[model samples]
Target: MNYETFENRVLPVKNKLFRFAFRLLGSSEEAKDVVQEVMIKVWNGREQMATIENMEAWCMRITKNLSLDRLRSNQRRATDSLTEGFEIRQETLTPHERTEIHENMQRVNEMIAALPEKQRQVIHLRDVEGYSYNEICEILELDMNQVKVNLFRARTTVREKLVKINAYGL
Candidate 1:
């Protein structure tokens, strides 16, 4: 692909790709690095890319693999930070509101982190990244049924956890 065409076509997806990487890796800097690496790889393989049926799926697959490799190499559990990009303003909030928001966010993050790897990946692609089932299957190299099952399990697990947390006032 020509540089202009590649930029016009693929560049728009960078933010989405970066967000996917960030959600998976839980580090903004690492996510940015993954996006750069994935883009470079795509650029290098542009000739072969022409033969690929789904460029978005292909790019997502590359991003997921690279992010997983980075995670494995680091040997660290994923930890999401609300303070990923913009610094939290110290503007005072009512104590009640602050506590409620903090608790809810923490609960959500913990539930997501607690999900199984395949389930978490499916959730990230389907929910967070807004990918269709077919695209998610392509990115994850899983069959359609597997993708559906994992996504169902992931959402169900998260919903159950949230219900329990609410019932117990956690």
Candidate 2:
């Protein structure tokens, strides 16, 4: 791709890339670095880009791999804080409602964080990023059945935990 085409197509996905990196690495600074690396890598490999379709998915795959590499090297678990990307409209809700929403979101985030790595990744790419199943499969390098199964298990686990919490007022 030419510079102009790269700027138009690749630059726009930086936020998505950063978000995915953050989801995996659980650190904003590290996520930014990973995104920068991805940009540089993509630019350097521009010749190979012509043959590939779905630039965004390809970028996400790179982000995932780099983030996983960092994680493996660091030997630390991801402490994903979903509120970083989540926004609650302050103007519409009272302070109490806002607090309640924040707490609920935090609870859900904890539930998601407790999931297995693959399940967490599948859930984030599919539900949070709104990627289609095929795109998620491409980004995650999983088959359609594996992606569907992981998503189903993640959602079901979260739902059951929420139900239990509600029923028990826990």
Candidate 3:
């Protein structure tokens, strides 16, 4: 319950919490605010913190709930969304090649974002964050079967969309 204990145990998961929050809320500022809120909430409830087994997961669950609450409070059907940016080596490829790659990456990102809500959340938690099924279940408050089914359906939808793009050159 002390500041030192909370710092030692819970502070380390800030980045993970930020990423999860950002993934849900899709704005860096909003995500940072959510992470701060999560930290404060955890600190306030520090007396009960030791009862939890996985501190990181617990923090993540709080981040998820807070992020979703923010979304609902805003009453926004859509978020600003995030793009996965990467550096270009500038070695073996021409500007045309780089542009093509960037376009493809953006297309893939749009496809994922277009997925249904539950599918997108499950995909992000499992694929992007690399959380286990049980952890995702806890975070999403879903059963194991529902998590797996959502993940499977999400993957299939992505694959099908990619195939359409590649096959039709669309």
Candidate 4:
């Protein structure tokens, strides 16, 4: 793929890739590094990338592998803090709405953080990143049935937790 084509088609997905990496690595700096590495690899492999059936999936697969590698390498460092440097965008919401959304997002993020790695990945790809099942299966290298099962389980778990929290007025 040409640089122009890559910029037009692939660069738009960078934020999603970075968010996925951030969620997995829990560090903005590491996530940024991962995204740069992923993009560099993609640019170097652009000739072969055109032959790939699904570019987004292929890119995500690369991102996931690289992020995992970074995570493993960084395990020897200080433990990851629960509070990463990620900030919620505040441009659009009114003060009251922003506070409410922030509170809800915090709770949801906590719930997601408690999920198993596979489930959290699936839910994030599907719900947060808006990836289709086929694309997620491709990125994760899982069968269709397995993707469906994991997504269903993850959604169910989140729903149940939310229900219980509401019931308890938490």
Candidate closest to the true structure, highest TM-score: 2
List TM-score per model, in order: 0.87, 0.93, 0.88, 0.85
lDDT of 4 by residue, 43-93 (tens): 999889857988888888998999888877766322245455536686877
Best by lDDT: 2
lDDT of 1 at 52: 94
Ranking by TM-score: 2, 3, 1, 4
lDDT of 1 by residue, 1-170 (tens): 99998899888889888987887888888999999999999999999987999898899889999999999999887766644344224558777777667767766877887787889889988888788888898999999999999999999999888788779976
Per residue, candidate 2 scores C-alpha lDDT tens digits across 1-170 of 79999899999999999988887888898999999999999999999998899999999999999999999999988875767656886778988998899998898878888888999999999888999999999999999999999999999999999899989988
| Winner by lDDT between candidate 2 and candidate 1 | 2
Q: After superposition, how far is residue 157 of candidate 4 from its true place, in Å?
A: 1.4
1 against 3, candidate with superior lDDT: 1
Candidate 1: worst-modelled 10 consecutive residues by lDDT: 82-91
Point out where model 4 deviates above 4 Å: 76-97
Q: lDDT by residue for model 3 over 6-79, one digit each (tens)?
A: 88888988988887777677778888999999999998898898799988888988998999999889865434
Off by over 4 Å in 2: 80-86
Better of 1 and 2 by TM-score: 2
Q: Give the whole-model CA lDDT for all candidates, comma-separated.
A: 0.85, 0.91, 0.85, 0.83
Off by over 4 Å in 1: 86-99
Model 4 worst lDDT window (10 residues): 76-85
